[model samples]
Every structure is written in structure tokens, then in C-alpha cells.
Target: MKIALAQTDIMWEDKKANLDIAETFIKRAAEEKVKLILFPEMSLTGFTMNVEVHGEYYETSSKNMNNDKSHWNFNRTLDAIKQLSIKYSINIGIGYIEKELEESKGKNKYAVISALGEVISNYTKIHPFTFGTESKYYCGGDKISYFNIDDFKLSTFICYDLRFPEIFQIASREAELITVAANWPKARINHWVDLLKARAIENQCYIAGVNRVGHGYGIEYNGNSLIIDPLGNVIGNCLEGVEGLIIAELDVDLVHNLRKDFPLKKDRRESLYRELAGEIIESIH
Candidate 1:
């Protein structure tokens, strides 16, 4: 499968400007015959906690519903991208802050839309960046989701979820390709690169990490969007301090062959590990 990583600079809290920039990248990726294109975390807005301006309303009544107007700018952005995906016949993965009526706090999510312009998968970030006070504003998700695109079984994750290996391991059981959309800063870029490779190697699955470039708020993001093979080799990289699209072709057979050869997952002792971890947590508490 051919995939494109859109490494671009996000305009701070400017959805209109960001959507315009994203449209250009989507068109360019389509021109290259990219089957799937992935964007960074909060693709339309920078990592900001001001939910009132950046967040979209979850509920829309008929009284407020106009074909011309949306309850949230994020909805309009998705509408445009869905149309573009259908027009280009390419699958698109977008990261955004999703506002849900049940949860007024909103959550960080990534949605994958098929070439048919239908939402195939919607995954909420399981881990919120508490250090940055993200947990205060955004609610963390409790489940992992996987979807199918042609022959590939894919899973999606957001920025801070990259640090958790257990979730990747769970997804790897059924997924051959994993996508990570991140807003990782330059200061801790080394961690981003190392963790991506580690997940790919340990899980024996293809990993595509799409991170943003340039600065957001006061933090500098170096892009470093990467595509790693099952053997932990970097097949496609955006390098540091660059903004553009990076494309790579992934093979499903490679993941199968590697797993057959190594069979590391089959050897895992999940029950024992869970017991040990539980004990440790209990002891700490």
C-alpha cells in the first residue's frame, strides 16, 4: 500500500488557514497517486487548550442546522476533506479535537475516511499529555480501534499514545499497519524516533508516524515523520526541520513473513505480566 505523510506547519488556532493548507497537500498527494495520506495531531489547529475557540459543538439542532453553516469549523473541514477524498479516490487520515455531546470535555481523535467518503474508523487518543495540562481539557479514550482498507488491517493513534507499547501490541495482534499522528516537539524528537522504531520492531508491523513541522505556540516541532518496516528499517523519513509530503509503499507479506520467522508475540506471558503490573501498582498505592 502507498501512503503519504503530510508534514506541514499548523497555523495556531486558525482553522480556515490550516484547512486551506491541508487542501493543498491533499491535492498534491492525490496527484502522486498516494493511496493514503496522514496528517499530524490537531492538524487544523495547534496544540491549544482554549477549547471554546478551537473546539466544535457536538450537538446540532435543525434550528441551527443550515446546509451552508456547520455547528463547528472542524465539521466543515471534514466535509471538505471527505469530498476531496472521494474526488481523488484516496483514503485520508485526519487528526482533530472531537467534541462529543456525551462528553462535554471533548477528546483528541483521528478519523480515517475511505475513498467512498465514508468514515471507516474513528479512534480517540488513549493517552492525553498530562505534563502539558492536556488531560485537564481533553478526555482520554479507553479503547483501541482497528479498521480495514483493502488488504491491510490498520490502527490509528495520536501523539502521546506513542509512548505506550501495550496498546501497539494489542493492535498488532490484528493490524498490519499502524498510523501515529503527533505534534512531537524538537526537544524530545529522539524519543519519537526511537519509540516508533521500537514499536515497529517489537510488534512486527509497519508503522507510519506523521508529525508536524515548524513552531506551534512557543514549541519547535522538527517533523521527523517516519515510515518504518517490520524489520525496524526506516524506509521513509521527513528528516528534521522540513515541511512537505513523504510517501512510502508498505507490503503486507513482509509483516506476515517476519512474524512467522520470529513469532515473538506468541511467546508473550500476558497473564503473568498483568498480575505483576497489578501488584506493582497496588504496592505503590
Candidate 2:
């Protein structure tokens, strides 16, 4: 299947403008015959800690939202995205903030929507970036989530979750593709590039890292969006500081065949690893 990574320039706290920009990329990718499109985190808003100003509510892990058109969802950014997916006949992986009961903070979430507008996977960010004060504005999730599409098992992760390899290993146990939606800045672009390749190599799966390009909250983000294959090859990437689509075709069977040929996972002793990292696996529940 072919996928497109939308490296866009998000306007700070402006949902309307960002949605318009996202639609343009979706239309272009659809014309290019892209099956699935992935967008950076906070698709309709830049990386801002203004939850009270920009937080929107949608159904949490609800599959019936496609059939039942709620009033707020019908007019909001997610509804617009759903309409675009149905119109373009493509699936989408995007990120946003989920409004919970808390007034000051929200849940950082990434979702996969099918071509028919079905909600496939709703994953919340497991590790909030404490260095950037994301922990104060975004609540972390307890569990990981995955979905199946086009005979591929796909998992979702947010920006800071890329630093944790144990969760990636656990998710790769079942997932053949891992999608990361991020708003990473320019200063640490090297780390973003290096960790993405490491994740793909160590986990033996496809990694799609989508990021924004322009400035947000005084931080410049030169988008280093990338797509890598199981053997640690850079299959798709775009020039830094540019806003465009990074397209690639993924053969899901390669992941299955590679694991079968190498069989590196068989050497892992799950019991011993669990004992070494006490209460880590227990927290997944």
C-alpha cells in the first residue's frame, strides 16, 4: 500500500486555517493515488499549551461516531477530516487533543480513520514530554493501541513515546507498522532521525514519522518527515524545512518474511526481561 506523510505548516491555535491547509494536502495525496495519509500532531493547531482556547471534544474510542453524527463533531475539525476521508476514499492517521473532565489539561491522542470513516485506532500519548511542560498540559495514557488495515497490523504513538524502546518492542510483537505523529522542533532533528531508524531496525517493522515544518510558539520546526523499512533503509524522506508530502510504498509481507528468516525474537526470554524491568509490563494493563 502507498502512504503519504503530510509535512504541513500549522497556524498556532487556529483550527480553521490549519484544517484548510490539511485539506489541500489530502486532495493532492488523493490525486497521487495514496491509500493512507498521515499528518503531524495537532493537525488543526500548532503545539501550544492552550487547551482552554483550542480543546475540542470527540467520542473516545467509540466506533459508532461514523453512523451517528453528533452536533459538535459535525462542525468541528474531526468532522471535517471525516468528510475529507470519505470524499477522497482514503484512510488517515492524525493527532489531536482530547478533552476530558479536566479544565486545564487534555489527553494527547492519535487516531486512525478508515476510508469509510470508521474509527480504527484511538491511541493516547503514553509518555508526555516533561521537559517541555507537556505533562502539565497533557495527560498521559496507560495502555497502547493497535489496528489492522490492508492485512497490516498498525500501532500508533505520539512524539515523546519515540524515546521509549520497550513499548515499541511490545507493540512490534504484533504490529508490522508503527506510525508516529510529532511536532518536533529543529534543534533536535538529529535525534528524531536517529531514533526513528533505530526503532525500525530494532523492531523489524515499518516506521512512519510525520512532523510539522513551520514555526509554532516561537519554536522553528524544519520538518524532517521520514519513512523507513524493516532493514533500516530510508525508503521515503523530504528536504528539511519544506512543506510537502513524503510518499512511499510498503510491502507488509517483507516484515513477516524478515522476522521468519532472522528469528531474532526467539532468543528473547520474556520472563527474565519482565523480572529485570519490574512493574513495567504490569503497568500496561
Off by over 4 Å in 1: 57-74, 101-104
Quantify all predictions' global Cα lDDT against the true fold: 0.87, 0.87
lDDT of 2 by residue, 1-285 (tens): 899999999988888888888888999999999989999998878887887656667555344455454423322656777888999999988787776433457888888888898888888899999999999998889998989888889998989899999899999999999999999999999999999999999999999999999899899999999999999999999988989899999999899999999988899899998796777767775
lDDT of 1 by residue, 1-285 (tens): 889999999999888899888889888998988999999999899888876556653335223445444443446556767897898889999987766434557788788989999888878899999999999999999989889987899999998999999999999999999999999999999999999999999999999999998888899999999999999999999768988899998899999998998899989999999999999999999
Evaluated against the true structure, the overall lDDT of model 2 is: 0.87
Error of 1 at 122 (Å): 0.8
By summed lDDT, the worst window of 10 consecutive residues in model 2 runs over 66-75
- Backbone Cα, N, C clashes tallied per candidate: 0, 0
Query: For candidate 1, which ten residues in a row score worst on lDDT?
Result: 57-66
